[model samples]
Target: MDSEKELSGKTVLLMAIATGIIVANLNYIQPIEGLIADSFQVSKAAVGVVAMLTQLGYAFGLLFIVPLGDIFNRYHLIQIMLSLSILSLLLAFWAPSLIIFGVASLLVGITSVAPQIIIPYAAYLAPSLHRGKVLGNVLSGLLTGILLSRSVSGLLGSVLSWQYVYLIAAIACTILLGVLHLYLPRDPRQKQHMQYGKVMASLPKLLAKEKHLQGSAINGFCLFGVSNVLWSTLAFYLAHQYHFGSGVAGLLGLLGITGVLFASIIGQMVDKYSPRMTVGLGILFSTLSFVIFTSLGHLFIGLIVGIVLLDLGTQFGQVSNQAIVQSLSLQASSRNNSIFMFSYFLGGSLGTFFGTLAWSNFGWSGVCLVGTIFLVLALLGHLFLKEPEKLQKVS
Candidate 1:
């Protein structure tokens, strides 16, 4: 055993590793959609099957894996999941067909428990006064992971085979896993309330009982819908419209990462002022991004500006959403986060599915429409959201 004494400095490093693990899995998959479709000799629509499966896998992980935090020793659970994540990524890399690729992606998604583990870990580490800040910083890494994964993958896809990308991630995960085992703080809690059937049964009642959590989750869903539309299809649109190669298209992801780089600022603001204010401002930025994109008329600068607004707005809303969801269910933070994140990814899957089709049909104009609608709906959800009793007490 390490020590009953705190791991101190290692917690942040552990959080970073956890964030990186999922980023390596999820974002890397975005730019390669077209490539994978071609590899499978399937229509673009079928690529959605892959996206859906990956998200479904994530939802499964959220439901089945995250709850263990409230029940088991998180230390052991994280190690097992991290190891499985490594094996899953390897299987994904060496898979024979797109069919196998999809399956591996699903498993990798399932085992990518990095975020679930780390968020709670952050909660466990910080004092209440600094809890939101710690979470924000850690989550910023997760968001960055989500952004850079696409950006880096797009930048690298043409130069190297996609399998090598997963291979690189596998190596990274292995190093991080070892580091975590060596240094991560031990869990303070034990497994107790893990009746899987009971947890599943309570979801509906939980949703009904916790309207605030539901609303926050809905808002997150819409926010992710906006982001996923762009990420899932932007490479195709940029390539098809302006005849730019993967490199420039990938650079757009960096432009959007501007938002992620600023998420901690939003977190700070959430601590200082109201989460609603940050969310409202984010909605405005998101709307501006969509409008600029539609009017860009294939000018490169227009694309750059669009990326900035979209990413910033998306992440701002996300940071606030995380704050709100975490506040709403102190007893069931993991479960609440799971539901909230699952909705967000579900919306992403829908955005990726329909957004890709819309792109093929109406081009950038179509994507702008999808993003605009989702952002608007998200804004509405945020506006209508009420803080639960526990959140108010925390505030």
Candidate 2:
């Protein structure tokens, strides 16, 4: 480990920007799903499969590819992944059939694991005392990319065609790939020469032995599921309820910046206080957001407030939970992060799937119910699960 080398602010910003740009590939199709449905002459519910498959592919990458970070040169691995990501984006841009597009989406998700790699690398480079704050700043960039991706895609899909969004994304990735090559430092840590099989096998053992990992993973699963439930069905709801288009749905994503603003602040709180406290606050804000959604979602202002709270709550829970998981072991940091992120994105996949199902069958009411159920499960895990003694004293 490069424990002695201090992480510079400029490098941290670079990593954050790299993560934001790379991760944006997985989200560009979300706001534009409705447009995609129209282009392919498919039902709104059927088009949702694209979103589900993308997240599932992300989960698959987290489990299989991210662990390689511990074994290989992460800088090389990231460059290779970003290179693959550009190919996938171009494939999506040129896809003629829905099936081909779905396949390209899956590939895009699989190759977009660079952000996960960068995150663990950042954690390793940062000082333990300020790790949470550093993570928060990086996460802010990531969250910003996620929010803006929807808006940009929505606007582009509104003006141009939906496929152009993917083309533009490909060009963006190509540019970022060059910038990272020029400025990003190579991994300074010595490589672990463990066989890939052994690295994969160790994941299950880590989950079984680490109570804190188990708790944090479950919290991540449910909390992220809650966030996806709302986001996955949001465009459909707007179209049905208010006669809105993909453009309006995309605009709503801008509201989530309100939550992104709090990411670093929440990270600082995790550093000074406890991950548990921030997690509880996250759950509280998420639960309240759902309450607003269920009761007052008919109003434009109500939806806006709910969106802000949902993002805020999700930011709090995600950053704090990650800090806890990353703190468990620096040597195993990549593997640890893979486990947490796998569960997290798995929840996202299922959430997108079920939220679409709920919207199809029971409308917005059903979507709210599904989100509530996820929150209830998250609360149970947060209140009942125990943290490690060392984690309780992060300061």
Query: Per-prediction RMSD in angstroms?
Result: 2.8, 1.6
**Cα TM-score of candidate 1:** 0.92
For model 1, the superposed segments whose C-alpha errors exceed 4 Å read 1-10, 387-395
Cα misplacement distance, residue 345 of candidate 1 (Å) = 0.9
lDDT of 2 by residue, 1-395 (tens): 45435468888889989888888887887788888999999988887888999999999999999999999998899999999999999999999999999999999999999999999888888888888888998888888888889898888888999999999999999999999999887888776789999999999999998888998898889888988888888888888889888899889989989778888898898888778888888899999999999999999999999999998988898888888988888888889999999999999888899999999999999999999999999989987895443353231
Write model 1 residue lDDT over 310-383, tens digit each, in one string: 88888887777777777665556667777777787778778877788788788778888888889779777866
TM-score of each: 0.92, 0.97
Please give the distance, in angstroms, between residue 44's alpha carbon in candidate 2 and its true position after superposition. Answer: 1.1
Most accurate candidate by lDDT: 2
> Which window of ten consecutive residues has the lowest lDDT sum in model 1?
386-395
Candidate no. 2 TM-score: 0.97
Instruction: Give the alpha-carbon lDDT of every model.
Output: 0.74, 0.89
